[model samples]
Target: MEYKYNKNEKTAYQKGYRVTKEGIVIGKKKNPVGWLHTNGYRRFKIRDHEGKNRNVGVHRLQAYQKYGEKLYQEGYMVRHLDNDCTNNHYDNIDIGTASQNAHDVESERRKERAIHASSFIKKHNHEEVKAFHEKYGSYKKTMEHFNISSKGTLSYILNKES
Candidate 1:
């Protein structure tokens, strides 16, 4: 079955719990307190206010706590500045559009590619790579010759596509 997004109020009601600004989830009625359990991604289970158990990313919770409720809305996403999901500190979390988040991820990938390319260039001269490409007449063959794993980086170096 498809899962639903965690609604703060709804989850609190269904789980008989209330999450405080301090990131403490207190249960109500006969439910237990401090029942915050993390999934591998540091998400916690909450029976949504609709009575459906759902896992909420802790970073979102932390953002909610720090920025007040309603921090997340449709088309909005929570981003980790250090790209570490587990680091849910208030200062580390912020809101951004889905595209902005995607750009951040792409920027990180570009940085990695640049690093790999620099190392590859240091190991093999530009003339050598150009000759290898010319001899093979195939980007894939040139990549195989250079043992380069990122095709994007290879394209950037050979085709000047960035």
Candidate 2:
């Protein structure tokens, strides 16, 4: 839950460091090999004296320190482009907004939906959605006759124009 760090706890082996809390050792210190054992699950999660999670693996910490302020200002989270969540190397990380971050996971699907919805909104609402449909006949004919994108964002445009 919490790892207590102190000056005296610093050791000769950089990774061979363990923090404690309430006089109890949280986890065994790890050696360099053991630290990067290629195991998917890490044996220990480095915690701060207060129990907050702060990844202190030299690489991760350096990344956080380097881009923390800039990311905070843009309201973006630093993401690992490699899709390896554990790899915090500076080269692999990028700053992204919440929507942009979500895009990383399902960008293609979202893009397709945006493009289609834009036309559907403009066409259907003008066609079958109103008396205009009687004059226009059908939605597809209306779409072919006009060429609107999606039907979803029509309200937004109408509101802005008003």
lDDT winner: 1
Which segments of candidate 1 are over 4 A away from where they belong?
1-10, 13-40, 68-70, 103-108, 111-162
lDDT of 1 by residue, 36-128 (tens): 344434555666545676766666666665555445466667787666655656666788776566455567686676567746575446557
lDDT of each residue in 1-162, candidate 2, tens digit only: 222342222321133443221111234433331144354422234545665644333333333345544534445555655555556455655777665555555556555565556555554454333444357656555445445443323323233332
Instruction: Look at candidate 2 and tell me the lDDT of residue 112.
Output: 58
Q: Least lDDT summed over 10 consecutive residues: which range in candidate 1?
A: 31-40
Question: What local distance difference test score does each model get?
Answer: 0.60, 0.42
Q: Which is the leading candidate under TM-score?
A: 1
